[model samples]
Target: MTDSKDLDQVRSEIDTLDQQLQELINRRAGLAQEVADIKMAEAQQARADGAESAEVVFYRPEREAQVLARIMERNQGPLPAKNVAAIFREIMSACLALERPMQVAYLGPEGTFTQAAAIKHFGHAVLDVSQDTIAGVFNQVESGQCNYGVVPVENSTEGMVNHTLDNFMDSGLQICGEVELRIHHHLLAAAHTSAADIVKIYTHQQTLAQCRDWLEAHWPQVEKIAVSSNAMGARLAASEPGAAAIGGDMAATQYELQRLAENIEDNPDNTTRFLIIGSEEVLPSGNDKTSIIVASRNRPGALFALLEPFRQAGVSLTRLDTRPSRTEKWAYVFFIEFEGHLRDPNVAAIVAQLEEQSILLKPLGSYPKAVI
Candidate 1:
């Protein structure tokens, strides 16, 4: 219904709008740099005033969360709110990099889901360090080698990532944010390999489980071998003859493999939840969640006693999981996630009450819930 002349005029207007957008983005970046400078001055003043441990923090999780939320709230567009927020996420990421580039560590060989999650949470401007293990990711963040770490906590299909949960028990790192990534697995082979020639299939154990039904239905006779990671599987598939890998699009692209079958997971809505760990505690974002670990005395109804206060305070419990307390045989530690920031009056009162009921009540962190 549109004419060529009108289209040409609209295209010209769009180009002008893009130029204005670029100018505004650069101006925002300049303001972020100024904010960094002011923070540096405050740090210096604190040190001069005998506050020796003061350090300037350029990234404010709560502030960024608030900004993203406001952006979504103000969105009036043909584009969806999430799409608008994602655009602002990159803009904020670039602005933050102008001040100080964030270093993020994740469990990876480069193309793993954790890497994707890290990018999703921190945006593309961050410096991503690929650690061989989830514990390594935690160690890097704890040692201050990276500003943040991303680790998988649970998969919708596979439940908990025990290694990550166990590491949290030992580490003091705070949960700064969370990201949920929808997973789509593909059956991939090297470009030269054909479907009939594929005898061996490689993938991570979880990936193998996810695609179990699909593999049985199609490549029933194929030898299924579990590898360390999906990235490694794709790597092997790329190098070996008559080999295929079960992994996501990222790995297939990164390893230059050809997709034979896409979205082969048994579950259509497969998803994984990853947590962003950091050394600093996040202040209250308007909407936030708090995570904690509680070890109660070995007694019947101990958990009920521990949780009763939350119910009494009208606090909503989001998740609760129990793990064996390594220090004591047969004793258990409960990991709890609840809505509301720890600083909230109801949350604070509930935490006080929980401490009295449990042998150990460790407040992991209060952070903004996932914004995008």
Candidate 2:
């Protein structure tokens, strides 16, 4: 038999800790409210002084990134670092909401992975607006209908989101932050579905490709259909007989479907990288990354001329992608991502050199690297 006195003592300690945490959280919220009031006053003063550009923006991506990083760094816990950071995320979200609720747009119809990424980066306190297309997400943010937008940029299993990359060519929105999500696809069906009766499978093209091997091995005879989003696949499967959808656990749960198989992806460590888009430029948070698009002249060694500056400066390049330039035939625009903020001296020099050599150079924005 368990010791009743010992159990009671432990429970009492936990209760005390919970009460203390609640009190501290509320105190933090009160401070956030005061900060908001001060910011409003400052904005009013700026307007009165005829400073048209000085607007009060509550959401600071760099600051939030630094805070999350500090929380992860200081963690010495029985619980995992991410779990602790996630708890703090909700606390910060609630406090920020006390200042002002943020509105974020994402590629979605709800239950999509982009929506999950938005919540992960912004926390659940912000309002989430779902758009049917990547263009829609960008357009909403650009039109001031939403403060920010989250869109998939690349996948570890798949290479890159071409549409998102292309959209950056014309959009004026900035890359404010980023989030990486570990994707695990599940084979889900409705409650009444039977394995033997399944004749068609539904999923996003990327999801279908990710699980190509498994599906080919098990359900080779079943017809695979590509949908706009995984959430759409789940919705279709829920209403159609003898239909199964390959999607994430979130979609399965949202559609009330049963998981016939879990982690059916071809690769075990599949992850998708998402970018947060907004209008404001973020200040440096110590560790940062800058993304840019460069179009070189149509000549020999054009690419080499564009990249030589970074090599000369000994800057670390994280990613480089090439897309056809919409304005020029047989010419391409290179999307490059590198470490260090644009404000850094070495990085600034390198960018200046590249601008001198390249036909066109556009700095997307510099923001802190992903913390969680």
**Per-candidate TM-score against the hidden true structure:** 0.97, 0.98
Instruction: Kindly list the per-residue Cα lDDT of model 1 for residues 161-272, writing each as its tens digit.
Output: 9898899888999999999999999999999999999989999999988888999999898899999899999999999999999988789889998989999999999999
Candidate of highest lDDT: 2
Note the clash tally of each candidate. 0, 0
Clashing pairs in 2: none
Question: Candidate 2, residue 49: CA error in Å?
Answer: 2.1
The CA root-mean-square deviation of candidate 1, after full C-alpha superposition on the true structure, stands at: 1.5
Candidate 2: regions farther than 4 A off: 1-5
Tens digits of per-residue lDDT for model 2, 192-306: 9989989999999999999999999999999999999999999999999999999887798889999999999999999999999999999999999999999988999988888
Error of 2 at 4 (Å): 11
**In model 1, how large is the Cα lDDT of residue 339?**
98
Task: Point out the worst 10-residue segment of candidate 1 by lDDT.
Answer: 1-10
- Which candidate leads the pack in TM-score? 2
